[model samples]
Target: MTDDSIYHVDGDLVPASEATVSVDDRGFRYGDAAFETMRAYGGTIFAWGDHLERLERTCEALSLAHGLDASDLRTRIDETLAANDLADASIRLSITRGVQPGKLTPQPEVDPTVVVYANPLPRGGLEGESVWDGPATVETVETRRVPDEALPAAAKTHNYLNGTLARAELEGDADEALMCDREGRLAEGATSNLWFVRDGEVHTPTTDGPVLPGITRRIVLELALEAGVPVREGRYEPADVLAADEAFLTNRTWELRPIATIDGHEIGGGPITARLSRLYDERVEHACYR
Candidate 1:
């Protein structure tokens, strides 16, 4: 693709090369930043408020400085979309501890470095159920998810080395890996949330307990509720997943997916996920597709 036209950061429309961060920033030096990936369609961002809320929550949990209030952030993002001439696109925003070179001592009072980059969103429907594979759910597991004590699993911080390590186990067989907490209860995926549909109820792990509270997961819950589906969140064993009638994963990039396997057997996204995925498509398609 041609070089990305200048994207927006903070307030300026700057060239990608000029969108720089100090080498000493904690986010760069120690991966001390937090980020959120969001998608925009039809000139409007999907779940803009929810994504902002989550970002704010992550910053609050880390006690990190939030450079701009939510309104300011939204206006900036809207400006970014206009600058990019976008109808559909993906946005990645990251903020790190400000420029302070080398040295181990952590500093907290400085301004956070914020960078926003926009790119074409994936075409989507690459595998939403009827679009691809035989079934939507697939098996994936590694060492259980990193426990909450090890690192805040709820925050979308730069510290994902544990998730990275877990995904190493997903390389060969599963489309994604189900990470468990140290206690071995279902945590979430290396990149998404795990949902099990059994006897018509939708079960996903609780965010306050474990797993990143994905923006998409929250939206799904609301949509499911509006559609009269019962959704529950709790601690689930991967072993429990094996007994489920259907399983699926949800992420901003993937939306809703049905699982056909967990560790080996044919555990699928079940009828619940299929109905849910269709509902999601019908709802989001209006918001995301012009």
Candidate 2:
């Protein structure tokens, strides 16, 4: 973000330096909020509908009725991007249960706080370059993902302590951390979804587990199926990934990042990974740059 960057706060566009949420806001006080990380290509937000659906699901999980329509949020995101003069960018949209009496229980009536912000990034398409420097070096962390029964894995909420602690275990030794569930089954990365290829099959941890159902992960699975590639989603162990022929990670920003190594073991991108990457790029081009 630049000095002149703009942010949309509660329907108003404000300078990044001046944008403020009340100290008493529930999102600040108790991590009571929902958000989505998105990417824009050629001035258009890719998978806008998908992101909106997930955001709505997250808010529903928190029982937060924001009382704002999709158009309102979309306009805010568009305005923020235009204000920042960014065509290709990374975007974040947050909706927090607004200020109420200081208590654990939220009020039925709500005055939600909404915020939208963006940072410029390289254009994404068939001709685009990756945001990542290179394939990520990941290490399996001892920190386990919070079980879905404890906290619904589908909700993209403000509480990210699980990922924070998992990443902290890295101690700068690796670019990412792979977290497992309480049963020692592979879940996901601190921020991205994990993927591995073995014997011409693409495999990832099932979303039914503690894994996040990532937007990019969904797209890759669809693309792989549409392209006639075998894909599987099930509980997996670290050893399963370690023995794979190829590996990668997925997120809104990273798109599909090849995994260079896991725990110092060399398991890099392969033909399948490259093919899926190209397909992802083509999807971006068709969606935004066409």
Candidate 3:
């Protein structure tokens, strides 16, 4: 997809300039919407099934008006990619609370607003300031990640003002921020899931924690277990991560990325991290969408 790629607004295919939603939509007023960022490769999406399931779950979590099903969203992605004449691109599918007139209530009379667009994303520059395969450093920022008590962090809703500001709180400490909950327990990265390599095993927080249960994080767990590497799901303290062999963050675009530092201390990218990274690559190498 190029800058000129069109957007599939509702059921019509229109140019990016021609697509627009109402300004007074509840999605704008109450931050009521659920969305997902999906990565595509080799004519197939990475974790396509998982992403869809998560999308369905997000809609269920937020109670958004569903006008299109998962199958229809997939077809829209295919059509948008074809219109752009690109084989690989990142797609965004957002279902707002629909364009309703009432500011107090958001029950819409027209169809729910479904927007799908694609953007051309390159292979990226790795972390912030490292060679392609080199490691990145993370630091604990000042802002605390909101616990599930206030707002359900599990739902990928539009209520991201806190997360957005927390990102700014990481200004110069390190390349990125690893957020901790109010109880001072490791939650997750500002935008990704957390994984620590220690004693030849990979440790991550369980679903009971407030983490988003990322699709890539789930993939890493499967990879670890399939490779005969121990994968445990439980609460891992910040101290445990510091004492571990290595640490990494998982997300869709880059999959598993190594972290060389946390909270100002240099971390070692041990053999275990290398083994997991390399083995996972070899296992999913065939899924590359190039």
Best by lDDT: 2
State each model's CA lDDT, in order. Answer: 0.74, 0.94, 0.74
The reply for model 2, stretches above 4 Å from the true place, is none
Query: What lDDT, from 0 to 1, does candidate 3 have?
Result: 0.74
Model 3 lDDT tens row, 1-290: 55666998887789998888888776777778888888765456667788878877877776665767778888988888788876556788887877676666656343667888887654321111222355667877777888787777778877777667767877564566788778788888877888887777888877677788888787778778887889888876789899987888877765667888887787757777777667655544456622
TM-score of 1: 0.86
Local error of candidate 1 at residue 205 (angstroms)? 1.7
Candidate 1 regions exceeding 4 Å error are: 9-11, 15-19, 122-140, 285-290
Candidate 2 global lDDT? 0.94
lDDT of 1 by residue, 1-290 (tens): 22766666556778777776667778878887778988776666888878877887788877777567777777777777777776567788777776764776656675777777777664443222333345443445557776677777768988878768877776455677777777778888888888888888889999877688888898899889999999999888877778888888888877787777777778765567878888877776666564
**Considering summed lDDT, which 10 consecutive residues are worst modelled in model 2?**
166-175
Q: Which residue pairs clash within candidate 2?
A: none
Per residue, candidate 2 scores C-alpha lDDT tens digits across 90-159 of 9999999989899999998899999999998998999998898999999999999999988899999989
